[model samples]
Target: MTTTAPPEHPPAGSAPGSAAGRLWRAGRAPAAVIGLLVAVSVLLSLGSEQFPSGHLEPGSPEPDGARALVRLLDEDSDLTVARTSEAAVRAVERSGEDTVLVVLLDHRLLPEELDTLAGLGSDTVLVRPSLRSLAAFAPGADMTGRVDDERTLEPGCALPAAASAGDAGVTGELYTAGNGVEALGCYPAADGSGLLQVAAPDGSTTTVLGTGDPLTNRELDSAGNAALALNLLSAEDVVWLRPDVPEEVGSATLWELVPAGVRWSLAPLALTLLLFALWRGRRMGALVPESLPALVRASETTEGRAGLYQSRKARDRAASALRNGFLERSVPKLGLRTDSGPDSVVAAAAARSGEDPQDLWRLLYPSQPDPYTADDEAMLRLADELDRLSGRLR
Candidate 1:
């Protein structure tokens, strides 16, 4: 009678220890690494300063800050203090058509952003813009004069905005408009108008103010400044964009320009590569000690190696090999330990062979540029000396 037991199945392909288990084991280290990285990034972000600081910053309360005017504007209109061009554009879009976009410190914005903002077609106020910014918002208009004296300039134009504001301390850069264009100038100066309003093709009006002083906390209450500032900024929705100076703008960093996700993928990719390397390493089994298929004679092996050394013109190496081989064989025969120091071995060999210690030392332990290493003939001479020395030792 015969009874057979069922074969034992391996744990790899059965039940809960299959695919899910392997995946978990393989991915756990990488997952932990990703988790730590995310935690560190969050902590660093939390510790950083988010608000930008500069002139005309809506939140700042310094003398140059427009926080007071911003608060006043907020009381009458839904005000959005935007730090970037995209944010400003988005806020304006959300607020609908009745929004008034105020752009100050325009030099901080890129040239392209300025062009985009100019196309927004909203009733806008430009406060002390750069030459390029002026061109984008107000074509054919140029800064012509600068008023050095900080004095009140009467609203010389018949425009409603200036007429309502009355006389104001708007003493700063002036501008002039092109001929026949629908334009109005106020705050009279010697060379150009302090305030210039020009008509846009989209039926929106772009009013350029010569100075930012009227909107600052310091001069907000002086003269007709408050009235002028309010008149220019009046709307149901107000978008104030005072962009931050782009970091190291003249020589911006490469990291700042890289697309966001590319920088984040490096860690996971490295872990994946490492896991692949480990898996490959695991598949390699223990090394087997393989015996020579056919035993090689010592003399034949020596001659083959010597032939290679001669072909390569390795005279120094050949000389060294010949001396080391002779010492290894002869030292043990002279009752000296294999690890005996060179000088001790040399002295013992010199005594046994009755040879001069200096001459034996030169022949056995050669330095660089030894006579034997110069040519094949010299190397042969060294081999003859070693053979002679070996015969004496016996």
Candidate 2:
């Protein structure tokens, strides 16, 4: 009987005109768009006041309590107003000559910051609303005011020197800026030259001014407190320091400082793109035509062969095919399985082939069929016999 081969099916990825191919062709546009969007957003944000930059206007007034003090100093004093924060204080101290260190403390001062201010040696002023009475009266004593008095000052008011009477260790004069709205505390140095601590009657200390708002532009115009603010900060070149809150500092540059995990992810992405580029541009071979034969169906051919085998009861033939298949598969594994068969066949073959009988027996009928348990001796003998038999057959 004459038989013809069926048509060849193309490999899954062989069609260069497939959807995957289209995607491969069109992928660059979206990537370019995304890159452009990111670039634009960064540029626009950099142009806005929200994005912090060194070249922009100094002492941009934020809508907070500090703005009052900021405006007051900017409008009234010869001092150049430069906004700063606690973190940048050292830089300001270093660069600023005759700089006024305004601590808008609306609460008690941290020990370290207090120590830092105490050591400044230059003139420093602590301004707020609640602590004015303290600076006006008590110069070095602790606050003797009640907690209710402390609470009476608005959310950003300085603490009173009287309230901190027992706790006052810093040596500075505390002065009041406004009635309950604002205050200032001045702490003088040992020679009575450098301003140290200022307290408000509302029971807030000079440290509180660093936190409260009488110094900000928003409230400096309200209740005639601007004069008081200018008077307090006017002695030196005004540096308007705005310390960034911890959360703001943390979220500030989020995208620029990519972490290690992101960097590793980008590496794999870059490699994948490189591989894709290599695959797309390199021409493999020419496409070949495939034609189907009209004679036979695959299913019919398989069923007919099975029926013929069954009708003939070709057990020996089937076994021979299985043995041949096994031999073909196993022989290449170190030229092994050449001596595989029943013992008599193995012995007859070994003798006829000049191979060891004992070794042939081990290959033909392994005592332990398990690969894990097969002994080294059996493996070695079988390998030697198989090699000899394979050489003879070849």
Which has the greatest lDDT?
1
- Candidate 1 contains a number of clashing pairs equal to 0
In the predicted model 1, the residue pairs found to clash are: none
Backbone-clash count (model 2): 82
Root-mean-square deviation of every model: 10.6, 18.9
* Candidate 1 local lDDT, 227-287, one digit each (tens): 9999888899999998876765458578866544545545555665687577656846788
Q: Which stretches of candidate 2 lie over 4 Å from their true place?
A: 1-46, 51-60, 65-72, 75-99, 105-113, 121-123, 127-211, 239-394
- Whole-model Cα lDDT per candidate? 0.86, 0.45
lDDT of 2 by residue, 180-251 (tens): 433333332223211224443534334322223333444445443444445445554654443333344566
Residue 337 of model 1, lDDT score: 97
Query: Candidate 1, 364: how far from true, in Å?
Result: 52
Q: What C-alpha lDDT, on a 0 to 100 scale, does residue 241 get in candidate 2?
A: 40
